[model samples]
Target: MKVCSVSVDLDPISCYYGIHGLGEPPAPLAHVVLQRALPRFAEIFQRRGIHATFFVVGSDLASDPSGRATLTDLAKSGHELGNHTHHHRYDFARLSAEEIEREVADAHQVIAQAQGSPPIGFRAPGYDMSARVLRVLESQGYQYDSSLFSSWPYYFAKAGVMGVMSLLGRRSHSVLGDPRALTAPVDPYRPGSGPFRRGQSSLVELPIAVSPFLRLPVIGNWLLVAPARVRTRLLESVRSRSFFNLELHGADLLDADQDGIPTQLISKQHDLRIPLKDKQRAFEAMLDRIAQDYRFAPLREVATDVQREGKLRAGGQNL
Candidate 1:
């Protein structure tokens, strides 16, 4: 059976500020992603009767009471929660092994408290996973890590943006991780000593969705902005993958005008200018298109099935 796992990275607005080289965001916007956008996600998913996995940053849950309430409420409604690290640091892959463990453990604790169950899955911040990061996850007994993104287009585009920012004398906090990751397998696999290679590790790596040949990212950040016809084409292209891990962010549901986001961010975050309703409509349409061919499940469930199966088919041969 074909599986499609939908997961949202609930990184707050401050992270975006750092990415755009805009230092600290206004104090009031700290919890905007959770307070304003999270409910929108819950509403849309509820309407379709879909259960998704939400990767939560531990610091958000620790600092925001209302956000914690909403997250726990979603958990009660049957959605799965995964650890997104405590700080959402874009430099997570470069941190020391001890630091990586602390980051994972801290988020694990808060998420377990909020959802009343320890998260069995994790997605690293900025889709940056290292051998050190994987070691931490294995030590904590995580079933899977869904952080390897093998889209060369996405990697190059990010590099170009960061390069421009540097030339213009703006310092973005985001890091460009090991280029070898751009060549990792696009499907789920047991990573080797390095997170990018296939091996016999216990923790599986469920990569984010990408198109076949060109490897265009089939994620929310791009799909939400693409024309309807383009979105349909991309969705059709990825239909061959047995497991489609579609990743979305809280910003996908935020509208600059309605949400009171400042112009500084709105200018850099073009998707924020697109009305929230339009993005929502496009998202629902994409889901409807995929629903015909795939069964939707949380990443944790998909990971469990993959673990039990032992071997996975990549290019007509089991790996």
Candidate 2:
């Protein structure tokens, strides 16, 4: 079965650039995401009959009254709500275990209050995670995390990093310079161990989808920017081996051209300057195509399906 899982990283506007800086107040972009982009995203998913998982930042919920209401509405609309950490911090690898626990716990509280139930899944900001972070997630009662991008669909960790390192050596403007050091893989698999493991940790890992060439993140640059024909071919190529996981940022759906976004990030990914209406049309079309070809499910359902597949492969028995 070709399973499709769509997820939105609900990070705050401050998280868009990097870590928070001193003396920066909340900006209009934050309100734009909460007020305009998110609702439209939800409506698009609903219109296409796609049930997506929204991995929300804990601080976004706690800080914005409207954001809290948006999250509640999404959960009530039958979409899954998951954690994207409180501060959208990228150095989970460096944080103490206690701090990790606090971040996850705080996010859980805010999500539970807003959605009327605690979130059972998580996705680290910038896909930055360490073994210690996983341990904290397990302790916090999270059922799964979509942060691990093992080199399954493509060799993202090895080849992708090599390319970034090469590019960075030439010039300093590479996106690779951003924190988190770009060690994530392109597909989902167990961390540090072989692909299949038993009696291991409780958290399930679901990685973002990427194309085979250069291991570019599938949803954002490749799928969103590519022409319709190219996007279709790319998704079809990856549909056979692994679950097709599409990830997006709330800002990706916003019209950067009309929205008066700061010129810095816009120039970073020039293709993003495409008109907002065009972006939405392309995104909605992609969702429609995926719905026609694959079964859309929440992360929990994907994990369950994988477990069941594993059991079936092992002499038709339950683990």
Which digits, one per residue and each the tens of the lDDT, describe model 1 over residues 212-309? 98999999989988888898899999988788889999889998888899999999988998988889888888888889988788988878777877
Choose the strongest candidate by lDDT: 1
Error of 1 at 54 (Å): 0.3
lDDT of 2 by residue, 240-310 (tens): 54467888888777676566667666665455588878888888777777776677887767766554464
What is the Cα-based TM-score of model 2? Answer: 0.80
Clashing residue pairs in candidate 1, if any?
A: none
RMSD of 1: 1.7
Q: Which 10 residues in a row give candidate 2 its minimum summed lDDT?
A: 172-181
Candidate 1 CA-lDDT value: 0.90
**Candidate 2 residue pairs in backbone clash:** 149-185
lDDT for model 2 comes to: 0.67
TM-score of each model, in listed order: 0.97, 0.80
